[model samples]
Target chain A: MKNTLWKALGILILVYVFAMTMLVPLGPGLLEFQDVNQVIESTREGRAVPEFQVIGFGTHWDQLPDSLQVFVQSKGQLAALEVIRVDDATHATVGLTLPYSLPAKSWNVLTNHPVDGTLLLENGLFLSDRFIDAKATWPAPSFIEHSSQLGLHFPYQPRIVETIRNLMLHVPLWFTMFLLMGIGFVASIKQLSNPRNQRDDDRAVASVQVGIWFGVLGLLTGSLWARFTWGAWWVDDPQLNGALVTVLVYSGYMVLRQAVDDERLRARLAAAYNLFAFVILVILLMVLPRFSESLHPGKGGNPGFNSYDLDSALRAVFYPAVIGWMLLGTWMYLVTLRMKRVNRQIELLP
Target chain B: MQGLAFLLGLESTAIAFAALLSVLSAISSRAGAGFGLTAVLGLPLIIPIVLISTRYGTDILNGILWIDTAHHLLFLGALTGGIGTLGFILFPYLWRD
Candidate 1:
């Protein structure tokens, strides 16, 4: 018992490590920043619109350096460029490109030259197109003329926020399900080979019950994800449809075992059905979703993580979560098996 | 099930009837009491995975378009198979008559 306890503790530590590595790093990978909503209220009515300060590490600023270089090449502004140092990074005031005559307020302190009457920020960071119209008179005709350059990337990166937490959901259910199904598979194979062993039959049935539980879980989790990712509670995508059918099929396997009264016949028939269903599960889950367009990973044409994506950080916790859950599940199965044996013994008492 | 549907194409209309028939066969075999007991005992096992699979599916998707529908389904199937199987194996006596 001491040795067993130590081994169990070791296994648990390994699992915790695994989950931490997989689930935690996902948060940083999908990191995104939000636009700082500065309150630019009109302090003094109309002498000048209050100048806004870009705050909260604005996301679209990365595009500015290239735009600045283009302006330099085009002779857009002869004004001397000055770099403002903020936290060891050089930030351009956009006012540097103006011809000294335009006040910082005129172009909203644009680091690039004013064109028409408006100023262009990095990657069309400026929300309005009228700014582009205003900056047309600036020397850089090439920069202000394009429409595509003006579109800013969307402000919020919800994918980063939502996807990192998914490790807890999608991966664990698969782990639990696989653990239960393996038992079912083992029990069925054992009973088929040894028909007289009621123990094997009991074990097989218990495995099926647990499997059905995981299957339902997989569906519920998938549905919740669908709402966020696909914006629907359910969709007819091949993957979604396939999973639904697979769960439904397995549920049938469970119900069949319960309805049959003859112990011998029930075991045999249920075992056969379990085998068939598992095979179909493999094909449905493994084979068919690959052939067409699917809104899921590991399918052709959909973007997914490559080998590099499963970095050391993710692998660390992920492997453990898998093992921990698998062990916990197995422990539960064994306890049930023991109880069943005891009950059977009690029933047999004369 | 596109697997069945893909194999049969539009012919799945025929298979659906058979699938329904199988469901009835299963229902008649299992006790309703057994089913309810399984549900009651299984809630804790089921709820967490339900929550986890969704969260992980999104994380795995992570703006990479390389993965398609089949992958998602397989991930889910593997998850269900793994966790549910573990539960069954771990708690066999729970189903004892």
Candidate 2:
């Protein structure tokens, strides 16, 4: 009864993850300000500044965002811009006039919408150094600023875009793999310490075989995520190589078990190999990737998605996904262990 | 000068691979599967040495001072020690039959 209860809970949480991962819309983001002037060199003679197009992701430009506020911010001051037209949900025509006695030559763009909240693009605008007309009237910043939005949203990442939702699906697979392998490692140590305990040997082999299944699933999901985001099915990367190597080593453990006919001899040999293979696992998965440059987040000085301001939104689904996947993996290992036990019992009977 | 620094990494790699190979060879001999068994078992254990040495060798080639690579050198030393220690402990059981 308890077994089925936990399995049901795992399924429930996974359902929640799937629903949230797909349904939650991404927060608005500034992609590029198209048709931007080469430089905002405002002249005293000609038209002040030309109109430019702004591109955004997940923006509601079509619904008449009367609260659409675009500004150039520098040195704790802002110059509000005029929105000339709205092309669609993703694009808007905006106009900005240079404010004299400006603090910096390059400034970022900040957009505030009633529905989409605030979006920013760093170094969105650049200006020449010659303009220093203190007497000139700067565009007064009179727009009423809106606070953070009320709706739930995942962060907008340029690399992964909408596919960032894969985080819930892809990462938990590897976490489950690690947990299963740890089980296998512990079972192997037990078999080595007491050779007469045949159950431990069966447990070790069963858990490891299940671990390999999880690891391969992790690789396939990871590869799909990579293809969608990194623009390649495979790339020369430290973390990827490490994961591949770890899986291959465990597969070799299986090969060794097959080649040896004697049960006692095979158990001892396979247990020994497990000890060595676990070291490789720690080295490749835990140690080496951190010391070198890796495209994977949280390694080699790259800040992970955890560092994002909107991380709480992701954490809401991500934590459950991890727990759910781990529960499911434990359930699989138990089933495999029982199958191994049945096989052993049948061998003895015959 | 770079060539000399790389030799140390290569040397550590050789010692690490040899330790892993000794155990693998015994298993292969017992299985009587020869190179097929050896290659599958050996590649995973040996690749870490290749991974670390390539990183170290590239550093030397790029003019990163030998002192700066203390971490990788330590990693290599630790890997060799680990494989050797495991071989020393497990070889007895493997050789008994």
Candidate 3:
């Protein structure tokens, strides 16, 4: 009863992860500006006003125009701008009045909609040279309060907007692969310590076999995501290369086992190789990728998704996904081990 | 010159070399050469895979275009093909013993 309950729990968590990751809408945010690089020139009539269109994603356009606020961040200070018009579901035009002596060459445009929260377009405008005394500081905009309740939603990330859902699938698969491989590593150690124990050898091989399946799934899902976001099915990324190498090395472990004919000798050789491969796996997947630059997150030069981008809402689903995948992987390994034992018994009967 | 070829075209070389080493190690184990010798011989052959992957991986991390990586991929493909042909011819001899 307990075993069935545990299996049911794993399946339920996975179903929850799948539904939530797919069903939840992306939070309201700015998609892009029609003209991100609008030039504002200095004029005799005070500040020069430049107008540009703003396109928002997942935003409700039914709100009043007065409620939509825009600001330009220049010289480390945010200056409030005037919204000239709000046109339809995704379009808006905002006017920015620049100071005569703006020290900053670039400015970021931020839109604060009353119902949609804050959306930012980084370095959205370039400021041209103007004639005014160099002020020590720029005026800061007053903090606008938003009262809209942004129900359950995934955080909006540029480039990986809709494809961000793949994170629930891809990352958890790798996590489960690592967990299963870790199990294999432990079993290999036990096998090596007690060379006579056949069960330890069975456990090691079973874990690795299932772990390889997860690794393959990870690679496939990662490739699909990369195809959508990075514009390639495969790129020369350190983390990606590392993952491929780790998988190949483990595959080599299985080949090595098949090559040896003697039962006792095969067990010993496989255990030793398993230990070595595990060390290499750690170095390839974890240590080396950190030192080098990679397009993948949590690696060199790239901020992890969990840093600021993975909001609490994502964490609610992501953590459960990892746990669910791990449980499922473990169950698969157990089934494989049982099958191996049964096969061995059948061979003995002859 | 051979070392440079192996270094620059590591992934393909490693794939071929790993297959060769696994076969050799398996044969050697049967002949009582033991796991130590198999590992010692295999380790050096696989190093190029690690070296080249990390070296080119840096460029990839900096977002190199696919066009720029064409040469690397080409060289890797050539090496793999050559080694695979060699392995096919030599495997029968290796397998008999």
Candidate 4:
């Protein structure tokens, strides 16, 4: 058991990661403002804006109501929201009494609490375009010191508030797949050069079989993440298509193995196919996805992991998760290789 | 115009498709692999070429010039080259046994 120290380390790291992934609370973020029914008539003339129920995640508005400063800021214009009442830490009511002279309707919400620091939401409120061109000089910016909250909390993103936790779960699977397939590719190349030693073929097949398992997991987890974030189980994105195609190509390798009758011939043929398939896999997954327009994060024009999306707190856990998954995949591949070798031995006994 | 684009696509498709078919048939006939196994192996490889060429054809029909379709054209060419080269190197090994 002590000989398999890395396997035990992988188990330990995975257990630690599972705990960290769920335990780390996300930072304060603005939820939607309750919609108001009172529509303003063309002008702010004699009309009063309704009190908006402000909702936030992990914000302490109730306890720090006195120090709570809410403002709708855009360009050079600014209008601080009047906190009429504090319902709870996550709920509050703020008067939307705009500065009658303020001309901007497209603005952002900024709230500063002594404890939680400043939470900002982009494109928070839009009064209407009617007042956008209104001839009025707005209030100057009230430059206040925005302090950072002291604690380990994941950075809150707009649409991916809580589901950002999926980064730890979904991305590591693919990275592990890439690593395993790469190992398989090297083994296949070695087998092709030295067909006399058939052990390399077993090693290649074991690595790929385990690799394919991880790839499938990556796809399913990616689909679920897409459903939560992109509002669909599947989309015709280039990265997605590339990944699906890569998996299918490898699956074809399995069928290729079944088609061949002789054991020696099977090993040689399978090695050749694996060599071709791995090159195609790299091109499809890595090269092609980068060139094409894709809906996946960090792709063409899609709002994905912005500058602050992959935060330091996420990296602390995310990097460990990736290494852990890779170790586990390697462990699985070794076990598969051992099992295949044992089966071959049993067949030879007869 | 679409017909011309499609005809060009059909020709290119035939070349790449033929390459795939030849590779699969050579290996299968050598081993007496069934039709299902041959197809199961071939489609995954051929589909990407078909996918790329279909896009190229669509672009041409949408009034994109032959010169403007350089990226797709070069890509299709590159895929064909990669396929041909892989088969050239690998087939010799299969021919031995």
Which model scores highest in DockQ? 2
What are the per-model numbers of colliding residue pairs?
89, 0, 0, 0
TM-score of each: 0.54, 0.88, 0.79, 0.88
**Which has the greatest TM-score?**
2
lDDT of 2 at A286: 83
The candidate that achieves the highest lDDT relative to the unseen native structure: 2
Candidate scoring better on lDDT of 1 and 4: 4
lDDT of 3 at A38: 63
TM-score of chain A of each: 0.61, 0.88, 0.92, 0.89
Candidate 2 docking quality: incorrect, acceptable, medium or high: medium
Query: Which residue segments of model 4 deviate by more than 4 Å?
Result: A39-47, A76-78, A99-105, A133-139, A148-150, A301-307, B1-14, B64-78
For residues A1-350, what per-residue lDDT tens digits would candidate 2 score against the true structure? 98799999999999999999999988778888766554343343245566677899878867756667788776566777777667789988776655456667677888888777677888877767536443444555675666556488888887678888888877898899888888888988888878876788888888889889989988998899889888998888878998999999999999999988888878888888888888888878888778777888878887776656337888999999999999989988999999989888898894
Residue-level lDDT of model 4, residues A1-350, one tens digit each, is 77589899998999988998999998888987765565333232355666677789888777757878778877766777777678889987777767545567677888878877888878878776344555666555475856655589888877788888888888999999999899989988888788886899999899989999999999999999889879999998768887888899899888888888887788888887888788778767776665567778876556555555777888888889999998899899989999999998998995
**Model 3 chain B lowest lDDT segment of ten:** B88-97
Deviation from native of the Cα of residue A14 in model 2, angstroms: 1.6
TM-score of chain A of 4: 0.89
Q: Write the per-residue lDDT of candidate 1 for residues A145-173, one digit (tens) a residue.
A: 32223321211223433444455556666
The DockQ of each candidate is: 0.06, 0.58, 0.06, 0.56
How do the candidates rank by lDDT, highest first? 2, 4, 3, 1
lDDT of 3 by residue, B1-97 (tens): 3344434555665676766566556545664657765665455336535455545555455667545654444534543554455445434444331
Weakest 10 consecutive residues of candidate 2 chain A by summed lDDT: A38-47
Residue A8 of model 3 has an lDDT of 89
